[model samples]
Target chain A: MKKRTLISVPVIAALVAGVLFAQDITTWIKKTAGDKPALAVPDFRGAGDAQPLMAVFNATLYQDLSNSGLFEMKPKSTYPLNNPQQQGDIRPQDGKGLALADWASPPVNATHLVFGFATITNGVFAVYGNVDDTRQQTVQAAQLLSNRYLGSPVEADAIRKAHEFANDIIVKFGGSASLLDSHIYFTSSRGGAGGFGTEIWVMDWDGNNQKQLTHLGAQLAHLAISPDGSRLAFTSWPLAGGQPQIGMVNAETGRKIPFYNQQASLNSAATFTPDGMKLFYSSSASGTPQIYTSALDGQGFTRITSTRGNPTEPKVNPKNPNALLFVDGNPKEQIYRMNSEGSGMERVTNGEGEASNPAWHPDGQHFAYAWTRGYQAGEFNVFVADIAEPQKYEQLTHDGRNENPVWAPDGRYLAYMHTPLKSRNAQIYTMRADGKEIKPLTTQGINRYPVWGVK
Target chain B: MTSEFFRNRNLTLTATLLVAALFSGACGKKAPIPPPPAAPTATNTTPSSTNNTGTPGRPTATLTVAPARIERGGSVTLTWMTTNANDVSIDKGIGTVGSSGSQTLRPTDTITYTLTANGTNGSATATATVTIISPPPPVTPAVTRPNPMGTLESRLASDLKDAFFDYDSVNIRDDAHTVLVGNAAALRQIFMDFPNATVNVEGHCDERGSAEYNLGLGDRRASAARDVLVQLGVPEAKMKTISYGKERPQCTEATEACYQQNRRAHVSAGQ
Candidate 1:
C-alpha cells in the first residue's frame, strides 16, 4: 500500500498521453441484428482496504455496461490467466500479463477489452480505467480511451466512480445520454398501515440508496418525475380523506411545492411537459375526468378533452409536445392519442381487456403500456407498440400483473410493477426494453408507479 | 259485546300459558331449586317460574347503576341481572358481559347503557341512564356554517345511502335506483334544512384490476351516481365527486360479498 496525499484538485483530466484510434469513433455504425461487438470486463486489481471498494466498483461497472443494451459482454470464465494489474503490465513482451493476442484471438475472442485498477491512498480513493481495441494489431496502438476518477473512500462514491467510468465507455460506443446517473421515483406502501398508505420514494438507477421522499401518511399514486428532475408530481389523497389531488414536491429537498387544488373533486395522473414548465393531468372538474393542462403556477388552466366519458392519465410526448397519449373510456378503458389541444383523437387499443399506464419511448414514435387483451383476471402485461403500426405490437411480459411501464431515459430499459401469480405483494422491477434480463428492484415492500427521472 | 268477551278470554288464556311455561323451565332440576320471590312489576322484570312442557322461560334483564349522577369524568358501577339467559351484553361500548355482572365505567358524556339478554325462548332489554354533571366541552367543536343546521353535514353522511356498483361496471345497478331514490329524498330534506350542506360522492373499487385504471373506474362510478342524483333533483352544484379507487375499501375480505360492498359510491357530506 504505497500511500499518497489526498488530491484536492479537480478529478477530471483529459488523456495527456498519445491516445489514438485507427477508426472514426464518433460516427457509430448501425450494426445489424445479432452483430453486436463483444467486450470483456475483468475484475479490477486492488489491495488492503481498497479491496471491498473495488468489489463495489467492479460489480457496478460490469452491471452498467451489461445493461447498456449496446454490446454482448464476453463471459468472465473465458478470460486469460494473469490479467494486467496496472498500466505497466500491458507490454508486448512474451510473458507479460494481458497479451493482446490472448483476448484478440481464440477462446476469449473479444474485440474490445476494459480493465481497471483501484487503490486507496491516505484514505482517499482513485480508480484508473482504460478501454482497449484489441484488434489494433499492436498492443501499444490498442489503447482507445483512458481516464482516472477520484472520490471519497466510501461505497456510494465508489459506485459513483464506476458509473462515471461506465458512462465514458458508453459514450465511446456512440450511445446518447447514458442512464448511469439517473434516478427512479416510485410509490412505496412500506410505511403505511396494512400497506394501504403509500408515499413517494427515489432510488438510483440500479436500485441503490432507496429513500423516502414524502412523509405524508396518506395514499399516493401515479408518480411523474419532471423533465428537469427538480420536482415530482403525483396523485395524493388529502390527509383528511377526500378526493385525490395532483401534488408536487421539490425532488431534491422533499419540500412541498404548491400546485393548485383544482375545483374538481378528483385530480390525478399528473405528467410534466417536456419543457418542465407545465403539467398535464386528469381532472373531474367538469363532471367527468378529462385531460387538462396547467402551468406550474396553476395559471392558464385549460381543459383539453371533452369526451363525455372518463379520459385520464395524460402523458406528453417528449419529442412532439403537441402530441399526447391518454386513457379514454366509453366501451372500455383503452389507450388513445390526440393533439395537445384535444383534436384528432384516435384509439390506439381495441378489442379485449383494458389498457392503461401508457408511456412514451424517447424516440416518440413508439410507446409502451400495460394491456390485457382477451381478458382474464390479473392478465395485464406490458406491451410496446409503434404508432406507425399499432396492430403489430410486441408483448413483453408473459405472466403476472405488470403495469405502469415507464421507459428509461435512453429508451433501452423499462421499470414497472409486477406481482406474480399467488403473490400478495407487488414489487418494482426493471428490465431491458426488449423484456430480457428481468431484475427486481425492490422486494421489501409493495412498491409501484416507477417514474424514471432525468437530470 | 261477544267479540270483546272472547278477546278478554283470549288474554286470560295467554297469561295462564305464560306462567305454565316459566314453571316448566325449572322442572328439569332433580333437586329442584325453588323459584325466586316475585320480581317487581317492571317492564324488564320476569319472575322465575316453571311450566309442564319443560321449556326455558323468556329471558329477563334488569340493569341498574349506582351513583346515577356524578361529576364529569367520575366512575360508576353498572350492574345487570338476567334470568334464564345464556348471552348478555351491555351496549355503549361495554360489549359482552357475563349472564349477570357489574362493570365500573367512566363515561365523559351523559350516556345510557342498555343490557340485552338473549335466551332460547326470547330476548329482553333494560337500560340505565348515567348523567354527567357539567360535561366537558367536545374536543372538536361542531362544524358551523352560515346555515341553520350546524352539524347537518356529518348527519347527512348517515342519512344518505351509498350506491353499490357491479364488479367493474360503472352503470348504476337496478337496486341502486331504490337506494338513490331514498338518498335523493334525504338530500332534499337536508338541503331544506341547511342549504350550505354539500354532498361528496366517493367512488371505490374492489381489490382487483390495476390501481391506475381502477382510479378512473372509480371516478366514473362516482360521476354516475352524481348524475343519477342530479336527475333525482339533487342540485348538481350542491354535489361533487371523487374516486378513491381500490385504496379505501369498505370490506377487505377476498369474497364476492366483500367485493360487492367495496365497489360502491359512498355519498356523504362534503366540506
Candidate 2:
C-alpha cells in the first residue's frame, strides 16, 4: 500500500503539471489579454488546371488573415478534411442549405469562416469570396473579387483577388471605410551611394507593387499623400545646398510642381485637410517654425499653432475640421492638440519618451506616434494612445527605430518606417492595430515617413 | 499517512503551477519568428548604411579664413583641413565635413570658429575667429538719400554690437541698450557715408521653433532690434528688417550653450 501511494503521488502530480501546461496554451489568446476572434480560410476550390493558381490564392488569403491583427486564425491542423465546393455546403442555420455554423464552430471554433471558389474562363481569371458567421450561420458579405483578362502571369491576378476579398472581410467586421485598394508613400535613398539624396517612393499597402515617385537629386525629408490621393506633398532642396521647401507631385501624370512661390517659405511636413481644399505645413518664413494652412492653391494663409519649440506635422482632425494635432519639443517632444485658431492647447501624451508624429485614426479619438526613450542611445518604437486618456498608451512596436506612423483609411492597420537599431537604412512596413501580422511594404533603401492613401 | 501524502502532492502541484504560470507570463514577444526572406532579394534597396570602419586613429585639424576681416555683408572663404580623422565638424552647424574643403561664409558680426575632428584613437580641435569690419565710410552717393552705415562706421572703429533677445521673445534685452546706441550712431553716419547702401537688420532665433515659425520670430526680433535704433534717432528709411528663423545658427551643438548664441538679431549689410 505504501509503494502504491508513492506511485500514485508521482503519477498524479505529473499529470496535473501536463494538463496545466496545455491549458496555458489554450488560453494563450483568451479574453483577458484580449481574445482575438477566430477566423478560418479554407483552400479555394477551382476548376481543372487551377491547382497552381489556387495555391497562390490560398497562400495569399492565409497570409492576409494571419496578419490582419484582428483574427485568431484556426490552425490548419484543426480544419475539416474536405473542402466545401458548392452552395449545398453552405447551410442556413439561421434557414437554407447545411448549417455551416454547426460545422465550422464545433471542431475549429471559428467565429468567422471565409470560403471561396475560382474559375478560368477564356483565359480570364475570376474569383469570388464569402464571409459566413459561424454562430448565426448567415452570409455576412459575398463579392466577386475580379473578372479580368489573364495576362501571362496568373499568379498576379490571384493576388488581386485575395487582396480584394480580405478587404471585403474587413468591411464585414465594420473596419476600414476606404475603398479596396491602397498604397503607402515613403522616402528612400537606395538608388545611389551613401551621400546621394533620398527621393520619394510608393508601394502597395500589403507590401507589393513598389515604385519610386520622385528623384529630387537632393535630400528628401517627409511626405504626405493628398486627400484625394492624386497628388503628393514633400520637402527637399531644389539644389544641392539650397533650403528645403515644400513641393507637390501628381500621382498619375508624374508632374512635379514646386510651390508657385518656390521660396515662399522654408517648409516641411505638409498635410492636406480632410476636404483636400486646404493644406497645412510648418514654415519658417515668419522666423520661427509655426503651423500654417493655406488653400489648395496656396492662398488664404492661416497660422494654426504658435507654441514655442516649433509645432510640426500639423494634422487636421478628419472628424473635426476645427481641431488640429501636432508635436512640440526642442529637445524632448510630446504630442499636443489645439483648435484651428490655435486655442485650447492640450497635451495628449505624458510621463516618458519624446512622442512625435501623431497619426489620427478615422475615429479621431485615438492616435498613433513614434516615441524615443530619451535623448540618449535608446531607439524608437511606435505607440498608439487615446487622446482622452494619456496614461492608457498601447505599445504597438517592441524593438526598432519605427517612426512616422500613418493610419490606413479603414482604421484597421498602420503603416510606418522601420529601421534596425543604429541603422540608417529604413524600410516601410504595415501591421494590424494589435501589433500582429506585420508585413513589409518596401524592401529597398533608407525609407522614412510612410503615409497610406487611396492612390 | 493519507494526510501526509495529500500535503506532499498538493505542494508539488502548487510549485509546478507557479513555474508554468511564470513561463506563460514571460512572453513579451511574438512566438515562432519566421525566417527572413532568402538573401539576394530582388530589392536590397537599403541606402546609407554608413558602414563605419570603426577603427580609431590619431587626428589633427586646421581651420582658417581668407582675409579674416571683411566689411559687413561681405563674403569670406573658409578653409579647413584634417588628417587621420573619421569625422569633422565646424562649430556653427557646418556639420560632419570632409578631410579638407572650403566654404564661402557670410557672417554679420565677428564669429569665433571651432573645428573638431574625431577618431577612435583620440580627437583634435582647432579654432579661428573672423572679424567683420565696417567699410571705410561708404562713399555717399547722396547726402540726402539717407544711408545707415558710413559716418556710423567712422565713429565706431569697433564692430557695432548686435542686440540680443530672450528665447521665443522679440523684446530686446536691457544689456543690449549700449550696443544699440552705437549701432544707431553708425547707421546715422551711413546716411552721410553711403546713401544707396541698405543696412538690413536680420532677426534670428535659436533652433527651437518650426523653421517657418522661427522665421516669423526672427523677423519680430529683428524688428524689435530695429525699434531701438529707430528710437535712438536713426531713420527707418536707412534700415530694413527680415528674419532667418533658426536656419543660420551661430553654434551647432545640441546644448543650451549653442542655442543661446543662435537667438540674436544680426546686422548684415544687404541691398
Candidate 3:
C-alpha cells in the first residue's frame, strides 16, 4: 500500500500540473515611423516536456518580429542573465532575476522587451506572453502588454499563435497590414521539365506550407491572385500549338472558373484591379498583345491600350484604380505606365537593359521591376523606382538573375525569384524594401513569379 | 487483490494511451494534409520497398488511352504510371508530369502519345495511340476519296519554306526575303488546290532570353513573316499568326546552330 501511494501521488500531481490558468489582456502602443524602437526578445521558457513545440514557437515568433521591419532587435549576447517567464517576472529586481534596468541600460539599450513562457499539458499548448517598456520607471508602468494564447499541441498552431502575437505587436507599433497569414502564389517547374511542366503553387509568406494550386499540364505564367484571395488568373494554352488564353480557377477549391475565349490567340499576363471586380490582361484578340480589361466573368471586354508593340504584364495601381502599368516592346522591352483609362501614357524606366515584370508598391507612386541595367549574358536584377520620378531609382540587387518582384502586403518587403550564379533553377526570395537581409524561401525545384496574396 | 489488479490495468492502459497521443501529436505540419489513400498512389511503392534491399532497379512505365478510337473533337483520357522513376513525362506538348496520373486530351488527328520515365538507374518509355475517326462525308456518290486535309497539309509542309531570323531581331533578312518569295508562290498554288484551307504562321524563338520576353519577340517574328508574305500578294484574311516562344524549340541543344534552327517562322496548315 505504501509503494502504491507513492506512485499515485506523482500521477495525481502530474494530472493537476496540466491544469493552467492565465488572464488574457492586450496593450496597444502607438509609435511613429521615426521611433524605430529597439526591441529585445528572449527565448520563451518551456514549462513541460514541450521542447520540440517550444523551439518552433520561439523561432517563429522571433522571425515574425524581425520580418516586421518596424523594430531594431538587440543581439542575444547582450541580454541579461535573468530572463522573465511571466508577467510577475518583469519586476524591479537586480541580483538573480530580470531587472528592467538591464534592458534600459547601455550595452542592451532595448526600448522595449518581449518576454514569455510556453507550456504543453496533455495535448493543449499555451503561451503566456508579455511586452514591457524598459524606459518606464516602475514595473506597472513598464508593463505594456500581457497576452495568453491557447491552441493545439502542433507545430502549425504554434506557428499561428506566434504570428498572432507578432501581428499584435506590429500593429501596436503602427505598421501596415501584416503578411504573416497571407500566402505567396508562384509558378514552379517541379512538376516536370521545360515550359509545359510549369504549374502554379502557393506557400505561406515565410515560405512554409507549400501546396500546388494548379495541374493544367501546360505552360503557365503570370500568376495573379484576386484581391480577395478567392480566385487565381494565369495564361495557358487551351489547345495544342494554339494561342495562349487567360485561365481562371477558384483559388480555394481549384475548380475551373468560366473565362471567355477570344477569337485571336496570344492572350496572356493577367492582373486584377484594386476592387477585383475586373481583370486587366494582354490579349492579341484584335491585333498585337495589348492591354485589355474584362469583368470577372469575362464580360464587357474593353481594350485599354492601342500600342503598336506587344504591351503585356498590366499591373493596376493598388491605391489608385485609374492608374495602370505594363511592359511593352517591339524588340527592346521597357516599363510603361498610363492611366487606367488608357490616357496620360508615360515611360517609367530609362537607361540600358530591358525592363520587365513591373509590380506596384503599396504606396501606388513607387513600383518594383526586373531590369538588365546594362548587364550582359541576359542577367537581370531587381529595382525599385518612383513612377513620377523615373530618374530617381534604386537598384536592389547587384548580381544574379533576380526578377519578378512582388511587394508584400506591408509594403516593407519584396518577394522575387532569384537564380544564383551557380544554380540553373530559380528560387523564391524575400528581402526588406531597402534590399537588406535577403532570405531564400524555397530551395527545391524551379520556382518563379511570386505574387503575394491579400490578407 | 482485485482492487490492486484493476489499478494496475488502468495505469498500463493510461501509459499506452499517452504514448499513442504523443506519436500522433508530432504531426504538426501546417500544410494541408493529403488524404490517406492519395499518399500511396503518388509514390511508387515497389521501388520504396526495394530500397530496403540496398539497390534500386531501372524505372518502368506504362501508358494507356481509354476509348482508343474516338470521333473528331471527342476527348480521350491518357493515363500513365511509372515505377522506380524520379521524373515522368508525356511527349507531344505534354512535358514533364507526375509519376502516376491521367489527363484528358482532345486530338484533332491520330497521335501516338509516348510517356517517358527516368530514374537514377535508367529510362523507359511507353506509347499509346489515339485514333481520330472522321464523320462519314455526306453520301454524294460512293467514291474512294483521300483525306483532303491530310494531303493538303503534307503538300503545304513540303512546298512552304521556313524563314530564319537573326538573334533578337524581327527585321526581315535578305535570306528570309528570298525564302518568303518562294513560299508566296507555293501558297498561291495551295490556296487554289484547297480553296477553303487557311495557313497558320507560327513564330518561334531561341532559348537565350526570358520566357516572357521571348514570347513577345516571337510574336513580332511571326507577324514580320506574315507581313512579308502579304507584300508578296498573299491574302491577309487567309493567314493567322501565333507565337510559340521558346516553349516549342526544334532543337534542345545549347549550340549556336541549334539556337538558329529554333529561331524561325514556319507556315503550317491551320486547323
Worst 10 residues of 3 chain A by lDDT: A21-30
lDDT for every model? 0.77, 0.65, 0.77
Comparison by TM-score, 1 against 3, better one: 1
Tens digit per residue, CA lDDT, model 3, B42-68: 221112111223344556665777668
DockQ of each: 0.32, 0.03, 0.21
Model 3 scores a TM of 0.70
Error of 1 at B136 (Å): 32
Model 1 regions lying over 4 Å from their true place: A1-35, A47-49, A86-88, A92-97, A192-196, A374-378, B1-161, B186-198, B207-210, B233-238, B251-259
Chain A TM-score relative to the true structure, per candidate:
0.87, 0.82, 0.87
True contacts kept of each: 0.55, 0.04, 0.28
lDDT string, candidate 2, A161-280, tens digits: 776677666555645464357777777776522364677777777767677776657666667888778888876653323345777888655578646432333567788888888888
Off by over 4 Å in 2: A1-35, A90-102, A136-153, A178-180, A192-196, A262-265, A330-332, A351-353, A373-378, B1-271
Arrange candidates by TM-score, highest first: which order?
Answer: 1, 3, 2
Give the chain B TM-score for each candidate.
0.45, 0.41, 0.45
Candidate 3 off by > 4 Å: A1-36, A95-97, A121-123, A192-195, B1-161, B185-199, B206-213, B230-238, B249-262, B268-271
DockQ of 2: 0.03
Could you give candidate 1's per-residue lDDT for residues A271-350 as a string of tens digits? 89999888888887877777889998566789888885568888888988877888876656788777787766767776
Give one digit per residue, the lDDT tens place, for model 3 in A1-455. 01111223333342244232211111011121224789999888777665678778888888888866678989888887888888776667674338888888878889999999888977788888889998898998888788988998888888899998988888777778878778898888777445456788888888888888777777777788898888999877533556777888888766779999667658777888999999998777776667788998777888877876678888898887977788877456788777776765656677366888888888675688888886863568888776555565678898947988998887778899898666657799998777776999999987887889864
